[model samples]
Target: MRGLRKVVTVVDEVLRDVGRPVPVPVRRVAVAAVVRNPWAGRGFVTDLQPEVEALAPELARLLTGRLIETLGGVERIEAFGKAAVVGLDGEIEHGGALIHTPYFGNVLRELTEGTSIIVFSDDRLPAGEPLTVPLWHKTAAATRSHYQTVQIRVPDAPRPDELVVIAGAASGPRPHARIGDRRTDPVVRLADLEKLENAR
Candidate 1:
């Protein structure tokens, strides 16, 4: 809370089916916060939970609020993901510590009314580096078209002793997806069985 610095929001939209009878437009919004890395310069600490627990609710509220606002409220949100990038001064574990908590994702799932478990990824990266956060249908994780990813980079952020944590929401799935679900599709199952039989 005390180290909370700045919040940046990015919204991306694409109309893949530009002039078709059924237009397909996908929109995703990402909100990221720059914060002081509590463990920076303090050396390795066995107990990182204290800081993670303390920061989860605060970061969650701020980032989730910004995402909802950027997407103009949450009803349109179809998928969600979270990411944290720690600076050179912090360990990858420090970055992972932020978004890997149950509290962090649970709050997001509740606020967005998303039934499926939230998707997430975190890493330590330099400024201007891209961070790809994978996402899935909020209510149907197995939906093929709903699988998506949001990529963002915070220019001039996480300056050695900082962290850039992001939360993202999407309006819908990819455009004109016909591949079907790999998990339960008949064709996919047949392909898998064929592969197994051929291997044997």
Candidate 2:
């Protein structure tokens, strides 16, 4: 929690869709922590591993805990993702260093009992700019119904020498998802297409 500035959490619930009541509301939550960037103002310092080791795991645990609590529990988390935004004075890689490594992502994965790799996004932006965190099914990456996103922003954060790290979760798939998953969708191989062309 070193150099921590503030924590922000947002919850979005979809209770109705197309003017119809949904049986189970879809809930998406995002937790973000604005922290001072350790590398900020240090021009081109080579190795980030030491600070990454020192910070990522604890940050991950804190954010993930907040996300799970806001969502009710780990069982409520069916989809998950992460994101980070670095302030203007910081490198985009500074944000990437915190959230991209296993030290950060694996904590969420382990706590949620998720099998699929957690999806993510990272960028450099000014304070108060909104960022969208992309999410997918926690256990099945190809589960199209669970593809979702949560947008988060802090009005005053990442002040030129800081990073906003985020974790996102969804309680369920999109309300009334009708599209089938990738596993059941028909596959079109390039070889088959070539054979068809030759026959034509």
User: Could you say which candidate leads in TM-score?
Assistant: 2
Per-residue lDDT over 11-69 for candidate 1, one digit per residue giving the tens place of the 0 to 100 score = 88877564543255778888889999999999989999999889877888888888787
Give the root-mean-square deviation of each candidate in angstroms.
3.0, 2.4
**Superposed Cα deviation of residue 159, candidate 1 (Å):** 1.1
Candidate 1's TM-score:
0.88
For residues 93-175, could you state the per-residue lDDT of candidate 2 as single tens digits?
Answer: 89989988889989889988898999999888888899999999999999999998999989897689999999999999988
Tell me the lDDT of candidate 2. 0.92
Off by over 4 Å in 1: 17-22, 182-184, 187-200
Q: After superposition on all CA atoms, how large is the RMSD of candidate 2? A: 2.4
Pairs of colliding residues, candidate 1:
none
**On a 0 to 1 TM-score scale, where does candidate 2 land against the true structure?**
0.93
Backbone collision tally, model 2: 0
lDDT (CA) per prediction: 0.84, 0.92
